[model samples]
Target: MTETPIHPWNTPQSTSSSASTGLTPEALEAWVNARLDLHHQALNRVLAETDSRTPGNTLRPYDDAIFELAASSSLIGLLNSVHPDKAVRDAAQAQAQKISQVVVELALNRPVYDALSAIDAAAADPATRHYLDRTLLQYRLAGVDKDEPTRARLKELQDKATLLALTFSRNVQEGGNTVTIDNPSELDGLPPDFLNAHQPAPDGKITLTTDFPDYLPVMTFARSHNLRRRMFLAYNTRAFPQNKQVLVDLLAIRKEIANLLGFSNWANLATADQMMESAANMQAFLDELDSASRDGAEKEYARLLSFSGQSQIDACSRGFWLEQFRRSAFDFDSQSVRPYFPYDRVQQGVLATAARLFQVEFHPAPDASTWHPDVAAFDVFDHGTHSGRFYLDMHPREGKDKWFSAHPLIPGIADHPSGTRIPEAALICNFPGGKPGDPGLMQHSDVVTFFHEFGHLMHALLGGRQRWAGISGIATEGDFVEVPSQMLEEFFRDPALLATFAHHYETGEPIPAELVHKMNRAAAFGRADGVRTQLYYTTCSLKTHTEDPAALDLDQLFHSLYTRFLPYQWIEGNRMYAAFTHLVGYSSNYYTYMYDKVIALDFFAQFSRSNLLDDPIAMKYRRTVLEPGGSLPGKDIVYHFLGRSQSTNAFANWMNEQFQPPSTI
Candidate 1:
């Protein structure tokens, strides 16, 4: 599902920009209030009118208006997470809940629901039909079908739930805890360059924030076990105990909502609108993947214990030991490969590959103002015709979100009064940034992340032009949304694509082909652990939503799952679920990560049959899987693209091969 962004962007040229730099906190606050009121007026006109064809009386116009709000609210949401100005960030946060509540209320509005329900979507265009269809489904899912009291209660729960979700995410973003390093010797065994860049504290004490750049280095390479433990505990436990209650309340509320919605549990209600259809099916799928992945995870953990000669493996020591084992066993070093992946060079490669794949062009928009100095905007074009634009915010800083993602805020549609609508998206990440002289370098894994997000961006760019705003761009089922991104990751894993841009930064030398081969060799080192970790979360997600919260012990449930699946022993006081922001939007849906991987690899299997850059195959993917967006069911899209349904054969084989012993026959 597309996450609603918390930040704003420059609106389309035909419309006024909702958010830009140099706006005061008061101005932002007033604008959000006024904008929401304006949105209500526009939507109220639609809701009040009985005829679907009258002015402001159709699904398309309603969609266009709500999406305008979505664009602005998401932009503010993004700014709340990453904007440097605390005042602006604070303002964004302050007004976010209000906007969220408004969105929920709008979905719950009876008049709007009745208006959409009265329309006969059967005779509408395919895209319009899709838009009306999904909107009606969303309305029912939003509890519009519930009787008055139940619906009112659901609204209350929704309001609270939205706040909780935002708070949980904010707690994580705020870094619930930070580890201070008073002794410089504790940083030993880490790269000298990283130390020099991160160490700036007085009294010779360096501070480590739980941000990925600071915390990951310490976890992966720090020699001191205590320091590593500290970092791990800090990272895992962030927003814990506090978010624990919030999560409990959130889960309990969802349970009630589900029961009211005529479902057995929250998971049922959540998946009713998704491709999974039922919790049982989701559990069965996860169970199958879990059973297959467990053996490899166990073997790898045992290997780690034996390799380090340690009695037990904890979360903190896992990364540090994994690095040591990878170096000795596979003869591959992650840091050593970094010199070839400076962010700037990698960015170019991604853009070039994207342009080539889509037969599109990108020109940097120098005069295009951004929310931040670090953000770069580009005008996208296809075959000399304007497509849309996108913004990239790639560097890490205090208060920035810790993960990578793409937000397609302003959707592309053609029915606007101002001619064809332009799709606009933002790509956000927290990779380490460079200083004045030196440039930032990313791990190959990070490059894969970039590719994955770019795939989503391209999906938004190419697919969002659906005639209706509601049915545009990457709007497919949550299970199928990651298909293209995952397929793109396979492109990165390809030796051919890696060689195209893996050139050394300083020496201007191509990466040794040996490095890429070793990467593939060690790819399974943490495969089981990673997969199992996600499974653990999925199980918890299912349990929390499927079962009665009053009868559940969340901490016990979390620890039990961790013990059952993970290599590391669960540490006390580390409430990982609190920081699991996916619980908000993707509750009972964490399995999509693994489930989508199978589909991704299956789709990539098609490319493997021909050249990686086969134009025919690429165009087929773009036209069928990319262009239709949610106009067709995900299954239909895949069938149209590949001439058949995707199967488990390719994914199962890939997993078995990855987990099999290197000397396997």
Candidate 2:
């Protein structure tokens, strides 16, 4: 297999202006906005043309034109943080979002899809025909097959869903716990940095927020079990006041859209393009997992209950007890590891890992125009030619969208390969900020998260033969897109890989082998609970999608369905479903995580049974899976990589082993 060219979207380029080369954020934004407007107008004119059925040969030009418009507009939105004026940034973002919505609508309209189909049928070249067919399928799956009225309704639903998701995330971000700790002794065992970050009022009461930096340390290390319970409840109940209604409406809208598109339910509609093609198949998979795991989860839960000093298990006690047990039993804790995994070191570790695995290079690029000081940019290069550049932004700030993702601003397309180097692609996360006494340190889990998101960055940066924006890296099957990232998480546990980066912040000592051993052994400690939680989410999502919107009690139904796995006497107001972002973002496709995990675990098995840092194996994986983009089916990619059908049995066995107590006990 030929090595793909390093596209500008994947590598970082300098945004700074020099006397030799003229480029400024202000100038770039203005030029981009003008270009976007021109392209938008051109697309509108073409779409409005009396000759809607353009010939196949002519479609490439039209498609290229439309893609350029969307790409430019979206990139401007992403880069708008450079705009000094808040109003300018807001206005640009709104316009860009509007253009994006319109582009989606155009792609999903029947006439546009018919035109693409005609193009596909008439194209003489095999590659051209394949591209057109793939494009046509995407449009159809996006709901282009619907009639005019339904299409209009679908657009409305899409817009509403977008706004609702944004709203829900905002509420969660702003909502945090305001703890009034009367005794400083309650803070015993908590990290000093965490305590320093939050200050007490005149009455001598310290406050805590639901933010991961604040909440995670408290939950993991605080001596007070009652405080941990309070924090857990607060974190879990985010956006509850309004999110319940938002979820209900969102579910109803999705169900209606799915029904209109000829699917039995939203799950079927959502999973059509995924490895698991139907809700029935997903449920069967989950059921098989439950059957395999029922005894294990119960045993773990009983052990946890006993550890918590509780005679009876209850809903609120599970999280608090789990953390306590994990710390006490394993002599391994997130707090103990956090000091060793500084944020900057973690970032370096991830980049270094990617470089070794994929033969790519990353170097920091200074740009004062970034949204925040925490946001850093990097340039990526291919080892062979050293010719391509892409940018990385790795921090969360106010007004920016909340989540972790690799957003490709410039999508690689066949026709527009060298037109405009999409200057930036980014991985955004909400990690803790640096402080005076302590530079921001991340837990081992956070280190894994850093690696996971960079897997997405690599996927986005490594542009394939195809260049269309819509069918780029993560634009593939929602179910399948996670495979690359999930596969990367395996690297976190690799001692060979950790030897390169994992170090103590104060003394710069390497993470101890004994700790690594305990970590590996305790790795499966809460595997059953994690899997069960995921299953509950998948079940709740399917139930919401498959049911009648008007007839359903959304909250009540979700609680009832998910609690089936819960032991009797646990309260119904677990309200976790209310806070499930996947129910909105993934819609009926929460099963993707499970589906992707099967593939990911299978992929991991290839390396786990061999050297984790085996370059040849990693290269084969990149070639077969990461480099394909959406040019081929995900199953084909998996089959090519693994040389067998994807199976969940190994995943089940892994979960069971994790839940099993140490033989020493």
Candidate 3:
């Protein structure tokens, strides 16, 4: 394999910017508050130091100080989301709003923007130029070009928006509702282990919570439609009523901000500088994908309907029937394969796969302690030397984000006197962790999710090499950001890789080759409903964000979108958007998941051969695609790596194949 270039911005590092271990609740507030103070001081110093290039410009000091503050803030933020102690979490959460407020204030400061803009950056290093350009874009996006009063209003709006988003997230975390199943008969088709592990209510009935472990299996396996419907409603209705007004206020504020920013709508404003550039472009992209997938999706739906032997379908019962159909057709039972994928074995496989392909090693970071016992630390070594570190906070509890993701905690920087700044990241997920004395086991789909989140973590750990903290580590455009995670799906699908670590937790036996083959063949069985379901989310998001929020009913919009795009009958009284946490973080960009899958597939075509774990291709991919982050345009990076422009042909074919006859594939 050819050696990849060690960019000056992210050379292999040996030091962590975090204290990492033993931060108590009492100290947490002081530590985080002090960091915020330092951040404000650094911003003021940067504004005070520079005016023009007639004299020498020296904002590097400002850059260093700000990044140091960012690193600390990231650690604090990570804790707030997943820390075991409620008090420490409370302090971090309190400090977070303050940090975001300060960040926006400094970023939008006219004097600061002017000072940075005045520097002669044309002749500077690429990273320096990247820093200058990115900073200016952020300032402009924050409304730095507005008049003083307008800017002040925008500042207030910005702070309110930040607080509102935080509020939206917190409501979901603390307010999610749970259900108790007082009837054992309601657990039909559920695994024996599930039944054995979850104790019945005091009245001798099984209890089910809306957590993924409880909710997903019932949706996908339980034969009782009434039970499934109850679970679905309870899960979908979480954070509702409370989040309903929150959404209304948030959408109105976003609209106001967009109008103030000289855009027609919030979607346009949000996508202004992203790869899509406007909501219209994103809509066009969605329209094209939907059109291409419609025929295949229709065929798949017909097959499902026929096999289901039911007159109609709904969100709750589709997965149950689909799994039934899959078993009858492909002779595969997904649940039966679970024992071969204990959570520990799956984690090993994921890390081992990365180690072989990317030439990185992961070792226990006993010193890099975290707030939660569930969170495990790993020191990352590249080329036999310590380069960076990241934490894995697998399994969920109350107050944690429901979805799976890798959050960047610190950016990797080179040539610092404190040794090369090591990148840090955290993987937050909710998989099935059985109660004490029972092993945590994962389904195949959960394994895929693990691989997907690992992609983001790897992107952060390896590609975080940037001189500027603002544009480091998976900071690619929103429309293309899902590519890395989606591309990792290709590896998980390879049966050869699956067999490498898949062994029965009790029997110590390898998964049978026949089972692997059956699973792979049925992998794309749900593509139609998956794609159609995404369309509802993406289209609803765009319309909700761009249209007049006051004139629309959140529930009505959700029902209409579902009825239009999905074959399933919409359930009345369900407020999906109210409980949709993505609406806060992803907002108008939910479509990117489908949009980037096209690009991800196109990228995956480069490694069509059998061995996905090959080192050379992996190294090339790391250098050309991962390391640069968003410093270069996504289009440029795609061309550099593939030697051609990206197109949607690959994704179209992949979607179509699912509906075709088995022999056709």
Candidate 4:
């Protein structure tokens, strides 16, 4: 039986829809089947084309299939992470797995590849030609040209890889462990509201889960070393023991797949299509970052260690000591700025800043139906023409995924037979303050994170209006994807920008420039250490895929890498890899964050600091950097905007900015 189509964005802006009233499990299954049928039909049409291959007869149908499948897969995939109901989430996971399998099978489909190969894209427009070339390259990479038996095996391995990835992520989402405080006094040094909200239960004990809201504050502000240690263990070891084997098996499968594909290792295979080019290149980049940050990291750690009077700062105690050091050295208390960054106001500021910078307007879709009441939907208009829609699911809850990200739910295609398909995206985050009377006083870092994710949302929406769905939105190379997000983070440091939105929750007084200055100075001190930490993760991700999985000791590798890049004494039970969800999606390329940081900083430096929001450069950046999406190669995008190759000089200068004398007002 067929169900009524409920395309994700089909819900009107004025209607309130919850998970209970939204698509049920049965409806989701039927919807998936319907979409898959359309996908198959489109591909079949490509194969059935009797005339010479043109963009319309062949590539158009192929792109249509991709666009349709993405809509089903992306929306259902998001349900697995954010849908409040477990049953819906589980069904979504199953459907997503099924969609993934179909994708793998299509990638290996010989007939479609042959048909696409026949197309003379030389006669087509530049974007269409690029689309064809990229598609052909991807097909070769997917082993569509392999012998029949090899193709079969590759498909099987890829399907298993998909399942393993799902399993690993599900474990992390559902595997949130908790720490219990035996004495309420252990909560001392935490924010007053945090202490109030976490009052002892009837047994006079407080329980904290590994969710970000609970874990971050405890790690940063708690005075009790034992409490911080316990919280760190709980947070780090999430999905441990279980995901350990899962990861090992997944890596082994990836290694085998790489071998079959004639690649040296999974790292080499994964990066082949990206800007990094090769694993050796990735290593060289990481080494440069390591060398650049080494001395500064050492000095920063020594300063923190001396300030704490502890012989060695445990990994768990790093945030605690750093906070104290910032207060003592830079005269900044992170908590002192929290009053000005209530979640709602920070949200307004992010929207306003983006609007002013990008020349867009955001209107609240108050009556829009979302999976949860906490989610806020907004429709975006550029120069008064409706552009796209975005959702803000910005709080934590039981059974929700713990990480923050922007999920593109619907791929926007500019030219479709039915109509122009406008894009839709959501920010799935775990920021504080969604409860009644809980202002969700965000740390300045949280405000930065909000800007970071919104950057992705903007990318998805603005870049979405392309002729082809495959190239629409954040479809750029995997390595280039983080530039927009991280670049937006730099804007959060602007005092004038912060003054526009950061106001005390009760008093409504804007944050003082002096406080903003101190906050930024304190935040800058950790840049080198942050870079080192990223290197540790980047190295771990690279090594895991490059090294043999059968004999690899994950614990030994993790601990060794930590010691190599960080000065913190490693705790015995830290299994951060288990909960490192990036491993599932990013695979062996966690270096993406650091690599893109270099580009992001270079891009940020192009804007005039004094007129950041109103700078003509902002609009130029939107057109040259963000608007192109994946239609152009990343290097081309960078060149068009910055007129040169991206430089690490900007990042290096940023790393040392904390040591530079403060600029006079």
Candidate 5:
């Protein structure tokens, strides 16, 4: 039942190691350079083989190189996002660019592609065959067989693109802005814990940052319109004027690269390797979702305007009005549930729920070193078998990235000479309440987010026990990767499950069922609007990638898209695109959220709603959909789990649930 443990070695044979936890900037740089050297040595071994190519001689070395880069580069890249020291973060960024250059070279390497192409995978296992097929397809997509000059140009352009992306993300990560409130009375409607956290300075001035902990509460609860507007402007404009040009340059470069690769645009090129298949298909999917949710969104907006007795609501006021509407119409105040979800309790609940559903236990790894003292590490055990390790950096701090994401640090490899390489991952988030006295009272949505990100961590660890590192955990199509996260989000609504961990911080009383019902109903009221907003973002992502970037006006496109999908009046000077980090990662495929939502809702429908913890379908889903990793195609994963193609019926029903009587379960 025992799996391999991590070792503190400097060679490629080492299964696992800590991130740049205690390393100085120079040591971190040297560590990355050493890993790159090992990665190159592995690739050189693949090329030096003169005998007949086999999976052993060709694919194994290639995957080992991939494992080397994935194991080290991911952690190094993460430092730029979450590391506390600016000097280390900067060095990590430079090293990250260097790793990207190596990646670009490997993608365009001719001899390596030739060696892999020579492999006869007919006698190999299905996973190995699939791995080889996908690798060759990617090589072809990278134009590996193109002329030397073209490949050289592509390499240069890709390196530039990589640098631009890093610049864009760095701007967002370091671009947090602050707003000052002169009068304490203006903070009315904010929760008491938040007020305590932000007591006025001796000069009688209170300051707030655009970080989510401050931004979400202030936008959703603050009573002052001017304050909300100021916060909104500061938040949406983060990295603005700086990332603006960087995005333009990135798009232009992407378009050029796509043209060189024989695609219409970056959207088409990006989707070529994804589940959506094509940009036109992506548009069709978005159109179907829009048709399904537009009517519901219109009704919800009408009700909101009527409730507010206002002709039009600005962007900053949407959340505030929605909160007010929910309180008045559904008699549910989101704050009422806060005391039941203190950060520590919520963390315990999230871990316990995952353990029960997946049949795994989490043991705290207090001795594990992490980049920051705040990060908590845990070792996962399944039926007495050591599975993997994970870290949770779940609180906000100055100079940290302002986003919630699951980052895979090291890919698990089963055939290492020493033992199985235990996978490692981390969750970087900025939720509320991490201070000594401020019992991080989580919003209901924050709890849902916690569950959602854990879904990804589970996927990484469970699916990581694969033969090929290339198709390991979370290697599924980019569009399909969100299914697990989104599906787990639904579990947060179960009353029986909620009682297991959600309790009052002081009194320890489980949240009442009636209150849970009201919260779900109130939460449901905004479903359509949420969908519409997703569509707007998805379209913006698609349009910017598909259109001519030189002619595209980001501001005008944002305004037009906003009006087209939403009922709210556009706020001037709102530069959301400047901080749209997904543009750097997902490119035009932000529709992945909505697209995967359909599949996720369909998947969740298969579970026994009343007894989700013990449902056999949970394990079935883990095996068929999650453990397969990318060994099977995305469509096959869906079919294997659901016995058919995913349907939109569940999503449609979810959108209209607000109009129906609340579920009695």
Candidate 6:
């Protein structure tokens, strides 16, 4: 039988007036309290009805009810931010945590595991069996196999880790040093609006914040060496005062939790659901990449250093000089590309690419309620059939969530008793907004980011499977999840694809072919240095997570790791780990970026050989990989898609291609 389809937003019946209000803080708190009370009672009722041997059971209904309850609880937490009452907001967070804890408990129970296993074993159909298997894997990953005491401890550790992660991110977002520059010459190569945004002080200095929109331009383009160095240091040194200790404590807790769960290290525990699967493999992969790229990187660094002249090139000046050297050599910079990548046009380009690759249509939905005013929504149609709805929260705001791509609402089996088609999803991003008179254009990097995130958005929305929310889009192995998005990044560089959307914002002229070629050539210039830096982060994460927490001196450990792996010496008191949001979000799975890139390159190779827009290849990709989600093991999906065993050699080849020195003009 085909699995049931359900609307993504269908909610359980709630008689207590569905959380609307003109209520004061106290009344709002009371309303939240009442709802929590009802949910608590309902949960107890469901738990009582669910046991190891319940006959011809009510378990399915019970599970569905619990899922709705959990989703509603999470929604309340999200919506509470918009509440006028602080008390109501606090109450919603507390209540949501409580509900989440309970749901986690139920879902991680042995009985649930046994039931899922039974379903997997007994299901006659492949699809249903795959669904059950995926569900079972999620439970197992959540520590369902642990003894009661261990499970309880794991839950506590996870909860604490979640809260700590949030605190770490919040600290980074709120904390930063601001600088003011008097001379406009210091801001040379910056876009005009960036300069305008910062009001000049009565004394004539223009203020700058560490926000990416402000900082990146200065770092990339500023002519003032001292100013660029200062800004770069400040930007890199966020969360030092507050989050340093937090990182240490969080790392300790994670290590302890991993030990209790029978893993040798936190990396092992975290990577269980990822493609890499262990710290050793990740280390090996990094080591291989480092070995392969070290010569190329050193050569690139030497070329950059030579451009600065021996007398001026010191440790302090190297970074600033290197930036200048790159611009001089490439003759193409981010600012040069921005005019060709206007925000609205890029969105259309992204949608157009999707239309060709996946046979989907996108239409603007300007009326949708969004978290921020700048956010835009769209209705996504499958071959002219309405399939899903998505909102792009593109701009940043005070107290808004930070950078990351997410499906706040994932498409899945709808909760309707009479199954309805499951509408797909929404994607949120924190891209920058442009000021008046200038269209908000993106850099090529930003264009690739749009494509990458949309790749994820499409993965969530287009998967035609029913019944298994576990196997939906990004719900797959963390390491493997990035493959689809990474593959999409290649499209940004494709001339055919770029021709579709890349045009001058004001004049509507196509980006010159010569410019495109230059851009592509320049793309590989700093690749080795870039890849090496990423490897440092990935390696440091693995070391911190795998080591015995009590033995680690967080500062010294990070410093030592950087000194050993990175090309440069470690700076004292540089607490980069403190601001590493990925450590919290991705934890020990940080190596997933490289892991997925390997597969992504392989996938892109296939598209390069075949026509990128070939309908048959696209369908095959959708059927074998995208649609299957977590319904198959990552290895199985990859093998099936490639028709062969996976290899890391492709990653090495891609890196080689990237690190190849630019031919002399």
Candidate achieving the largest TM-score: 4
Candidate 4 stretches with Cα past 4 Å from truth are 1-22
The lDDT values for all models are 0.79, 0.66, 0.78, 0.89, 0.89, 0.66
lDDT of 6 at 553: 79
Per-residue error (Å), model 6, residue 327: 3.0
Across residues 522-582, which tens digit of lDDT does each residue of candidate 2 receive?
6668777778877877888788888888888866776676567665244544566656677
Model 4's TM-score against the true structure: 0.97
**TM-scores of the models, in the order given:** 0.93, 0.86, 0.93, 0.97, 0.97, 0.86
Per-residue lDDT of candidate 6, residues 1-665 (tens digit): 22211211111221123323333444434444554454455445544554543312433444454445534554454534333345545555565555666666665667656655544245245544665555666687778888888888888887787667657876886677687777767787667767776667788888887766677677666767677766766776887778877887898888877788678888888877666777887888888888977887787777876776653343234445555665678786656778889877888888888878887788888765443355567887776667677777665555544464745354355333546435445555555554456577777888898899988877777763445444544566778878888888987886666877899988998888778767876776766776787787888778888877777877787777665655554444466677788888788777778778878888777774326775478777877878776567778888989999667676666666645455521
Q: Write model 1 residue lDDT over 193-270, tens digit each, in one string.
A: 788786757777788878777887888889999998888788888887688888888888888888888888988877
**TM-score, candidate number 2:** 0.86
Model 6 alpha-carbon miss at residue 211, Å:
1.4
CA lDDT, candidate 1, residue 522: 75
Question: Model 3 compared with the native: what TM-score?
Answer: 0.93
Worst 10 residues of 2 by lDDT: 3-12
Q: Comparing candidate 2 with candidate 5, which one achieves the higher TM-score?
A: 5
Candidate ranking (TM-score, best to worst): 4, 5, 3, 1, 6, 2
lDDT, model 5: 0.89
* Candidate 1 TM-score to native: 0.93
Q: Give lDDT tens digits, candidate 4, residues 23-92.
A: 5777677778878988998998999899988888899899989988788888888889988778878988
Q: Ten-residue segment with the worst summed lDDT in candidate 1?
A: 6-15
Please provide, for model 3 over 196-312, each residue's C-alpha lDDT reduced to its tens digit, 9 standing for 90 to 100. 877786788776778788888889889888888888889888888888888899999899989998888999988876778899998898888778767777877888888887778
Q: Least accurate stretch of 10 residues (summed lDDT) in model 5? A: 3-12
The segments of candidate 5 whose C-alpha lies over 4 angstroms from its true place after superposition are 1-21, 663-665
Q: List runs of model 1 lying over 4 Å from the truth.
A: 1-20, 48-57, 659-665
